[model samples]
Target: MKKVVFKVGGSILQELPESFYKLLIELKEKKVCDPVIVHGGGPEINQALEQMQIESTFIDGLRVTTEEVLEVAQMVMCGAINKRIVSLFQNQNGKAIGLSGVDGKLLQAKPIKDGKLGFVGEVTKVETAWIDMILQAGGIPVISPIAAGEGETHLNINGDTAAGAVAEALGCRLVLISNIPGVMETIDQKEIIHHHLTKEEVEALIDSGVIYGGMIPKVRSALASLQGGVEESVILNGLEPGDILKYLDGEKVGTILSEKEVVEHV
Candidate 1:
């Protein structure tokens, strides 16, 4: 079965509509795609940290994960958020198994930023055979971004980075779903999302300051996914009804980020 890795942002999870999940079931039933979900829980983590009176910080879109913060992150991501997604799938009549990178050594990693980022990790390796096993059994894998090291060490990975790595490992499509619609730019003095973006075009936008902040990592991950042999990469809003199917059908629904603009198949 063809695979697609979906990276769902924390900000959108709480409001995910049932119809969004119905599309996943449709894809599975129709044999259109096998979907894997990698999720983030930044908002919930922040709230939990605040409630516990623990300080939090981020540098360049990566959470500066101190040991204390990592504890909070693991709880919110692996415990709360992961099961929420799994329950949603079950309620939608889809069989989903929630997992962490630590499970079955699916993802292996080492500390990044010379340990300055504490437990933040760069994905060194991804094992997709087990993921394929789940897919073969007609089960969707709902993954949290928390990873484990050699022993007694858990690493927090960026959701987009994790998703991109999974897509690269599977050599499949990558769909980056967020609350916002897509990558935006000012055209004719009116803000509009670029339907298709090339490397050069995206670079120019970054240089011109049209793309900055959180979007930098997102677009960069898309470029990285394409370079890593992912079939296609797109950034689109998950809340939009039927947008996922429309994008997969190549109907120009969202911002298509690519090394080059390839013709859509359907």
Candidate 2:
């Protein structure tokens, strides 16, 4: 059976609806493909931190996770968000299991720059065996981004990068579900970039500042996933019903990223 990794960001988690869950159920019922879900809860974590009167900071688009903020991030991402998604999948008649980077050492990491970002980690390894066990048990594994560190430490990993590592480790295709439809040619709200781009093209866009701010990290993550041996990677709007399945079915639902065009160039 083919496997695909779907990484849903906090933005989509906040807006996910029953219809979306139903679509996932339909995919399972049809045996379209085996899917493993990895997710983030940025906004929720930030809200919790704010309530605690803790200030948050970011460097290079990655959260500068101080210990206090790291606690909030763990509670929100693993405790709240992970369970909610698992429940939704189960409600849709899909067997789903929630996991964290800490589960069975599923994801191992080291601090990105030690004291620079406090608890922020760069994923060093992923144990795909545990994920395969969950899949074999007919469960969709839902992973949260908090990872336990080596000896008396805890690390906060970027959800997108974590998902990419998981996909690469499993040798599976990756679908990065986000708020936007896909990469845009212009920054205009309606300008959907419908064509596939080479690495050079993506670099040109980055150099031109057409892709800046939050988009820079996301695009870079997608590129990294492609280079890491995943067959393909796509960035699509998850709020739309059936968007992910549509993309998987060879429909032009989002911006697709790959090393080279497998299908007729479109």
- lDDT of each structure? 0.86, 0.82
Lowest lDDT sum, 10 consecutive residues, model 2, at 257-266
lDDT per residue for candidate 2 within 1-266, as digits (tens), equals 67889888886787877777677666766788778899988788878887888987878766788888888888998899999999999888888999899988899999987669889897888999999898888888999988878886889888998999899999888888777788887555656574466677778888997777777778788889887777778887777867787777788777777776654422
Q: What would the per-residue lDDT of candidate 1 be over residues 80-191, giving only the tens digit for each residue? A: 9999999999998999999999898888889998877889997888889889999999999998988878687889998888898899999888999866678887888998
For model 2, the superposed segments whose C-alpha errors exceed 4 Å read 57-62, 186-192, 262-266
Rate residue 59 of model 1 by lDDT: 78
Which candidate gets the maximum TM-score versus the true structure? 1
Residue 215 in candidate 2, Cα distance off native in Å? 2.8
